[model samples]
Target: MQLTEAHAETGMTLLEGPVFDEDGKLLVVDVTAPEGEPKVMRVDVRRKTSQTVHTDGRGAYTSAQFSPYDGRLYLTDFAHGEIVSLPPDGGDLRTFFSGEVGGAPMNPDDLAFDEDGNLYVSDSRGLTEGEDIGRVVRIDRAGKEATVLADGLAATNGISFDADHRGLWISELTRNRISHLLLGAEGKTASRHTAVQVDGGLARTDSIAVDADGNLYQGLHGRPAMAVYDKYGERLATVEVPARQAEGLESATNVAITPGGTRAYMTVSGPAGGYVYTFDALAEGIRQSNGG
Candidate 1:
C-alpha cells in the first residue's frame, strides 16, 4: 500500500482517535499539546490542511466519535475522566456525562455506539498509571443512565461493532489480544472469547476498525504495521507502514477508514513525534452511521 501524508507533523504530544465526519473531513484528538494542553482538530483531506475545532484546558482528549442519533460529536477526556460533546457546527462544547457509574470510577478511553443510539464506552480506569481496573459501560440514548456491560478488563481501549451487528469487538491492550463479545437478544454481551492474539512480531494492540466485509484492521504499537484479520479471526494480511514516512511510524495508535472505504487514516505517537497518515484501503470500510 502506498502511504501518503494527510497532515504533516504538528508537534502534538500524542495523537489518537481518528474518525471521518459526514462531509468526509477527518477528525482527531491531540491527547497532549506541545505546550501541555488538550485539543481536537479537523483535517480537510483535499486541502491537506487542519484546524483546531475544540480545545479543553482541563485535561487530555483521547477520542472523538460523531453520534448519528444526536448529530453531535462525542469525545472522551482521558485526563479528567469524563465524556463531553461538541456541536456539529463547531459551536461550544458541553459535558455529556461524568463521575462514577456503577460504583466504579469512569475513566473513558474509547467509545462506540450501537444501531439504536446506545453508546458503549471503554473505561480504561487510568491504565496508563498502572491501574488494571477497566470496564465497558453502556449509556442510553438519552445519556441519562449508564449500565456496566463488562468489568474487570485489563485495559479496555479500541471498540467497534461488527458489520453484521451481531457482536462487539474490544481490544485488551494489556492482554495483547482482541475480544469478541456475542450480543444477546437484549443487546448485551452474552459471551466473549479471544478473537485475535499478538503472538509473533506484534506487541500491544490499540484501536480497531471494521470494513464492510467484516475484516478487522488493528493498530500495532510496537510494530510499523496494521494487522488485518478475517471475520473468523484468521490472519489475512499485514500492511507495513514505512518508518521513513514519519519520525515515529512504528507506534500506530489508531485507525479510521473513510466512509467510502477507499482510504484509511491512522495516528502514530512515540518519542520522536506524533503524526496522522492516510493510505489506500484494500476493502470498503463500514460507515459509522451503520454502527461501525
Candidate 2:
C-alpha cells in the first residue's frame, strides 16, 4: 500500500504502528503528519484501500494498540510524552497514561500487552538526559500501577513478549541489539541479558513482534526489512519490502503478523510516502504480534 496524492504534505511523514483491532481492521500511525492531516489511518487488507479515520489536528502518534479488555485504541504520543486512547470511530480522545516514571520522562515509543491485560511500554527518549537513558515500564491489569521493569537502555524502541510470556524482547535501537528481560515468578522483578546482536549497517532497530513459536521479528528503520530471530537469538530470516516498492521506501518501522496465522505486514515510510508491505510469517503470530 502506498500513500496517494491526497497524502502530500510539506514536512516529514512517518508511519509506525501496524496492528489489527478486535474487528480485524489494520491501523497505522503517521508520527509526523503535519497540521490539518489525519495522524491515524485504517486499511482494508482485502480491498487494499485506506481511509483517514483520525485527524486530531495535532499530535505525534508513534504507535497504537487496542486494549484486549475494553477494545479501546491506545496510542503512544511521543510529542505529548504520554499515551492516549479512543474508540475505533476516533471519538472521545483522552489521555490514558501519562506523567513521569522513575523520576524520568515517559517517552514511550512502542507498547504491547500481555494476555493478562498488563501493558508494557518502551520508554525511549533517544539519550536526551544521558547515554543509554531508556526504560521499560509495565502497567498492571488495573492500569493504576506503573512499574519500571528495566532501565539504562540506549533508545529502546520496539517491545514484545516471548512465546511463553515469561519474558520481554526489547530493542536497543542505538546499539543494534535486542535484550531479553526474563520476568521473575511474580512478573514484577526481572533478569535481563543481551539476546540478539545485529549488524544492521545503516538500518536501526525499531519495533518488534513475537510469534506463537517464540520467534522475534525486529523492524529496521534505515532499510526496508525485518529480521526474524529465534528465542535463543539466532537469526532465522529477513523479511523484505516488496521489490517494486523497495526503491525509496526505506523507513521500515514496524511489523504485525496475523494472530495464529502466517500473514505478516510491515509499515514503512520515506520520501516516497508511507506504505504497508506484506509477507509470509515464519511462524504463527501470537498475542505479542497483535498487541490487543
Candidate 3:
C-alpha cells in the first residue's frame, strides 16, 4: 500500500506527540481544548483498538515520552509546565518535575531523553503574543531542581538529541528554525548555533525526529508537508501528504521517524480530527541534499 490513513475514529481531538512503546504500540495525547483537560491514548495498530491511558481533568497533556529507566510514561502538562510520571499500564500518576527556578518561564512543550536517562524539555514561553520568553530545560534523573541550558530564544517547541547524544536539535517555532547545540560531558554546558531555518509560508515547524542516517525530519503545521535535512544543514527533501478538503494532508504536528529511518509518522489534526500518517522511503528520495 502507498500510505493510507489508519484508525480514523480514535477521537484524537488535537493529536500532537505520538511515540512508540517497546511493545510496538503507539500512544498519543488528545486534547479537545487549547489548554483544557487532556487524555493519553494508547492505540494498538495490529488489533485496531484504542484505550485511554490516563485522564486527569486538569491541564491538557500536550506532549509525552516513555522513560527507558522505569518504563513509565512521562507526560507534559503544558499549561502548568509540569512533568508527571504515569505507570506503564496507566495507574498511579505523580509529579516528576515542576517549578521555575531563578524566575524563569519553564513552559515545557516536548521532551527527549539522553543515554544517561537525563530528560530534556523544550520550554515555549514566547508562544503567546506578550510573553517574549523561552528556554530549554534539563532535569537529571535524581529529581533535582531544573536548570535552563539555553535561553532567550523565540519559542523553543521541540527537542531531540542526536544518535550519539552529543548534539541537540531544537525547533524554534516562531523563528522557523532548528538550532544545534553542541554538548560535551556531564551534560554540563554547550555552545549554540543554528542548524537550519526553514522560512517559507510552509514553515510552521513543530516536533522533529532524526533518522538513522542523521537526517532531520521536521513537521510543518501550516502546510501539510515534512521537510528533510541532512546533518550539515541542507534541505534534502520535502514529503508531501495526500490532500484533503477539510483537514488537508497533514495538520502535520509532532513527527516520529522509525528506528530504521525508512518510515515516518505525523499526526494530521485539522477537520480529519487527528489521524496518524505513515510515509515510506519512496516519498523520501525526491530531492538531493543542498550543498552545505
Candidate 4:
C-alpha cells in the first residue's frame, strides 16, 4: 500500500523511525510536525492508513523499538536529548532516560536494546571534525544508570546488534561509514573498526536492521534507497524507490523488519511529503530488525 502525507500545510514531512508493535501494527514518527501536531503514528500496513498515537509541541522522536524484556516501547528523543517510553497503545508517557550522562550532554538519535533489557542510545551531537562529539551509551536493565560504550563518533545514527548478539553495528553519518563493535566482558566495547564504507557523495546512512543471516539493511538519508551488506561487510544488494514514486520522497530513513515477519517496511520523507515503501527481505527477519 502507498501511504503519503504532508506535515501541517508546508508541503513537508520527515518520517524517521519505523517499528512494529506486537499486534503487528506499524508505528512511525514524524520529525517535521508543527507544534502540538502528532509525532507518533500507527500505520495500518494492510489498509495503508495512519492514526496518531502521540503528540507534543516538544520532542523530536527519532526512533522507537520494543524492548524484549519489559515489552514497553522505548524511544530516542533527539530534540530533548532524552529517551522516553510508552505502552504499545502510546499512553503513559514515561521519561525513561534523560539529563546528562557520562558527564556529557546527550542528543539521542536512536536506540537498541539487548536481550537483558540494557538500552543503547546514539548520542548524536552532529559532525565535529577531529572531535567525536557523538557517542553510544548503555542504560542498564533497570534504567537507573548509564555507561558510555563507544565515543569519538560523528553524528551517530542507526544502531543494531548482530544476529548472535555478541557484537554491535553503528552507522556514522558524518563519516559515511559502518563500524562493528565487539562486546567484551560485561558489555564493554572490546574492539572496533570500520566494516563498511558507503559512497555517500551527498547522503549518509541512517537507521539500520539485521536479518537472521547477519545481513544489514542500511537505510539512507538524502537518497531513496536501502543497501544490504553481509555480515562480513560485503555488499549484497540495494533496493531503490522507483522513479515514479521518488519525486516528493527525499529519503528512506529507517527500515524495520518484524521478527517472524515477511516484508521490510521502510519509513521515508522529503520536501513534498512522507511515505512508506516495502521490499522482500533476503533472509528471515530477526529480533535485531524490529527497531535496533
The top-ranked prediction according to lDDT is 4
- What order do candidates take by lDDT, descending? 4, 2, 1, 3
**Candidate 4: which stretches are off by over 4 Å?**
1-4, 8-11, 128-131
Worst 10 residues of 4 by lDDT: 1-10
Question: Which regions in candidate 2 have their CA more than 4 angstroms from the true location?
Answer: 4-10, 128-130, 242-244
Model 3 misplaced stretches (Cα beyond 4 Å): 1-12, 33-38, 130-132, 244-250, 281-292
- Report clashes for each candidate as comma-separated counts: 1, 0, 0, 0
Q: Candidates 1 and 4: which is better by TM-score?
A: 4
Task: Sort every candidate by TM-score, greatest first.
Answer: 4, 2, 1, 3
**What residue pairs are clashing in model 4?**
none
> Judged by lDDT against the true structure, how good is candidate 1?
0.74
Name the Cα RMSD for model 2. 2.0
TM-score of each: 0.88, 0.93, 0.86, 0.95
Q: Write the per-residue lDDT of candidate 2 for residues 1-292, one digit (tens) a residue.
A: 7753225565567888888866677888888887667788888898988888788766788988888777788899887788888898787888877887777678888998877667889988764655787889987756677888888899889998788888888998889999989888656755889988988999989998888888888889899888888888889998887688687777678888887688988887877778888889888876788742
Tens-place lDDT per residue, model 1, 1-292, is 1112223333335677888877888777777653323377777877878777776457567778888788788888877778888885565788888888988678788888887778888887747766667888888878898888887787888788888888888887777788888888766889988888865355677777888888888777676567888878888887766747645555777788777666787777665556666777667767531222
Clashing residue pairs, backbone N/CA/C < 3 A, model 1:
261-285
Give the alpha carbon lDDT tens digit for every residue of 96-190 in model 3: 98888448546788888776667888888879863547788888876595777888888888787765568788888888889988886767556
* lDDT values, one for every candidate: 0.74, 0.81, 0.68, 0.83
- Quote the lDDT for 260 in model 3: 38
